[model samples]
Target: MYRAIRIHGYGGPEVLQLETLPTPVPGRGEILIRQEAIGVNYIDIYFRTGLYKVPALPAILGMEGAGIVLAVGADVTDFEPGDRVAYPTSLGGYGECRTIAADRIVPLPPDIPFDVAAGGMQRGLTARMLLREVYAVRPGETILVHAAAGGVGLLMCQWARHLGVRTIGVVSSEEKGELARRNGASDILIGYDNLAARVRKLTDGAMVPVVYDSVGKDTFVASLDCLAPRGLMVSYGNSSGEVAGISVRMLATRGSLYLTRPGLTTYIAQRGALLGGARDVFDLIAQGVLRVHIGQRFALADAGAAQTALETRATTGSTILLP
Candidate 1:
C-alpha cells in the first residue's frame, strides 16, 4: 500500500486527507511511477475549493510529479523500468506511487534533480507558453507582470530578460519587489494602488504592449490600464479572486485590448507541443538561464499545511511535497 492525499469534497485546506491505498499496476499505455516529489500549484487549490470541479469524489489532488518508473505496461515502448521521468499535467500526483498514461511523461535530464523537475515543469512551461506563444514577446519590448515574485512570474521575468525584453514587475511588498528585481525585473512596483500610473511612468508614458496578470479581480482593471492600444492581457490565474462582469465595451473602452485565459493543457494539448515545450523549459534550466527556486518542501502527509502556506501567500518560488 502507498499513501496519497485524497479529497472527498470541496472546501479549504482542512478538507485534504491522507489515506493508504493499494499500489496501482500499470495498464496498457501506462507506467507505474515511484513518486519522489510532487508540485503544489494554485490549480490544486482551485480544484480543492470546487472552483474547478473534479470528475468524481475521493479524487487525488495534484497535477505534477517527478519519479522513477518501476514498470511499464503493454505497448509502452519509450519508457522502461528504472527510467527517471517527470510529468507536468498528470492528475493524481499527490501520492507515493501512481500509474499514468505514458504519453504524458517526459524523460528527466540526468543532471536535473527530482525536486527541481517537480517544482518547475508546470510553471516553467507556463512561462514558455505565455512569452513564446501567447504574445511572441519581442526583443526590447516592455511588459508588465503581476505577482512578479511568484513561481510563473519569476520564470517569465528571467526568460523575458534572456530574450532582451524589459519587464515591469508588480509585487505585493518591498521584499517581493527585491526578489523580483533579483530575478531580472527591470523595474518593480510595490502594491496595487496607482498601478497603471506607475507602469506608464516606468515605460515613459507609452505603456506596455502586454500585461501578464495572474492576480485576478483586484488587479484586472489596473492591468488593462497598463497596456498599450491593442495590447494583450493574459489573465492566467486568480490568486486574489475570479475576474467577473467583463463586457465587450470594457475592451473597446480599454483601447481594443485583447484578453485570454489560457490553460497549460490547451497550450500543450498535442504530443509535439508537450514534448517541445517541456524540452525548452528543461533546456533553459540546464543552461542556467532559468533558475527555479524550491522555496518550501513538506512531507507528503502534510499536504494540507503546504496548501495553507500557498493559499496564505506565505511561500515564494515553488513549493513541493516529498513522498
Candidate 2:
C-alpha cells in the first residue's frame, strides 16, 4: 500500500484527503517513482476548485515531483532501480508513489538535491521557455514579469540577469518589490493603479519589449498596454483569474502585439523538446547561474494549507511538499 492525496469531489483545499491505495506497478514504457519532494503550484488550486477539469472524480492532483525510481517497465534502458529522477508529469504527482512514462523522467545530477529538483522542473523550465524560446529574450532587452516574487518570477529574473537582460518586475507589495529587485530586476513596481504608466516611466517612456504575464483577467488589458510596439505577451498562468473574451482585433489596435498562452506540455511535447527545455533549466541550477528558492514546505498531510497559501497569494518563491 502507498499513501496519496486525493479528492473525490472538488471544491476547496479542505477537499484534499490522504488515503492509502494499492501500490502501482510499472507497465510497458512506464516507471514507478517513490516521491521525495513535490512541487506545489497555483494550477493545483484550479484543479481543486474545478476551474480546470479532469476526466473523472477521485483525482490525484499534482503536476511535478522528484523521486527515486523503484521499478522500470519493459523496454526501458536509460534508467534502472534506485536511480534518482525528476519529472514534470502532467498529473498524479501529489502522491507518495507516481507512475510515469520512462521517457518523461530525467536523471538527476549529483549536485541537485531532491527538494531543489522538484521545485526546479515546473518553474525553471518555465523560465527556460520564457527567455530562450518564447521571444528569445536577448541581452540588454527589457521585459516585465507579473507576480515577480513568485516561483517562476525569481527563476526568470536570475536567468535573465545572467543573459545581461533587464527585468521590470511587478509585485503586490513593498516587500515583494524588494524580493524582486534582489532577484535581479532592474526595477520593481506595485501591481496596481496605472501599471503601464509606471512601466513607461521606469523604462524612460519606452515599455518593455516583452511582458511575462501570469496573473490573468485582472491584468490582461493592462498587460497589453505595458508592451512596446511588436512586443510579445507571454500569458502562461491565471492565478488571479483566467484571461477572458480575447478580441483578435485588439492585437492590431495594440501596436501589433503578439499574445500566447504557453504551457509546459506544449513546450515539451516530445523527448527532444523536453531534453532541449530541461537541459537549459538543469544546467543553470547545476552551475549556480539560477537559484530555486523554496519558500514554503508542507507535509503530505498538510496539502490543504499549502494550496490555501498559494491561492491567497500569501507565499513567495516556490512551495514544496515532503513525502
Candidate 3:
C-alpha cells in the first residue's frame, strides 16, 4: 500500500485529501515508480480550483516527480527495475508510488539529486520551451519576465543570461528583486504599477522585444504595453487569475503584437523532443549552467498545505514533496 493525495471536488487546498491506496500494478508498456520526490506547481492549484478541469471528481493532481522504477510491465524495453527516472509531463505524481507509461519518462542523470530533479524538471523543461522554441530569444536582446524570483522565472533568468540575453525582471518586492539579480536579471521592477512607463525608462524609451508573463490577468495589459512594436507576448501561466474577454483589437492596438500560450506537453509530445529537451536541461544542470532551488519541502501527507503555500505566493523557487 502507498499514500496518495486525491481530490474529490474542485475547490481550495483543503480539497486535497491524503488516503491509503493499493500499490498499483504496471500494465503494458508501463513502469511502476516508487517516487522519492514530487514537484508542487501552480497547475495543481488550477486543477483543484476548477480553473483547469480534472478528468474526474476523485483524481490525483501532481504532474512531475523523480523516482526509482520497481517494476516494468509487458512490452516495456527501455527501462527495468531499479532504474532511476524522472518525468515532467505526467500526472498522478502526488503519491508515494504510481505507474506511468514508459515513453513519458527519462533517465535521471547520476549527478542530479532526486529532489533537484523533482524540483526543476517541469519548470526547467517549460523554460527551455519558452526561451528556445517559443520566442527563441537572441543574445544581446532584452526581454521582460514577470515573477522574476519564481521557480520558472529564476531558471529563465539564469538560462537567458547564459545565452547572453539580458532580462528586465518584474517582481513583487526588493527581496525578490535581489534574488532575481543574483540569478542573472539585468534590472528589476518591484511591481506592475505604471509598469510600461518604468520599462520604458529602463530601456531608454525603446521597450523590449519579448515579454514573458506568467502573472496572467493581473499583468497582461501592462505586459502588452511593455513590448516594442511587433514584439511577442508569451502569456504562459495564470498566477493571479485567468485572463478573459480579450479583444483581438487589443493586439492590433498594441503595436501589432504576437501572443502565444504554449505548454510543456505540446513541446514534448514527440519522444525525440521529450528526450532531447530533458537531456538539455540535465546537461545544463550537470555543467552548472542552471541551478534550481528547492525552496520548500513538504511531506506527502501535507500536500494540501504545500498547495496552499504555492497558491498564496508564500513560497519561492521550486517546492517539492518528499514521498
Task: List candidate 1 stretches off by more than 4 Å.
Answer: none
lDDT of 2 by residue, 1-323 (tens): 99999999989888999999999999999999999999999888888999998679989999999999999999999999999999875688989998999888788887889999888798998888888888798888888989989999999889889999999888999998898898898888886689988988888988888989889988988999988888888899998888888999888898999998888788898899887777778888888898898989999999999999998888999999999
- Indicate whether candidate 1 or candidate 3 has the larger lDDT: 3
The numbered model that scores best in lDDT is: 3
What TM-score does model 1 achieve against the real structure?
0.99
Ranking by lDDT: 3, 1, 2
1 against 2, candidate with superior lDDT: 1
lDDT of 1 by residue, 110-156 (tens): 98999999999999999999999988999999999998898898999
Off by over 4 Å in 2: none
Q: Which stretches of candidate 3 lie over 4 Å from their true place?
A: none
Report lDDT per candidate: 0.93, 0.89, 0.94
State the lDDT of candidate 3 residue by residue for 21-137, as single tens digits. 899999999999999999999998888899888878799999999999999999999999999999997879999999999999999989999999999999999999999999899
Residue 309 in model 2: shift from native, Å?
A: 0.2
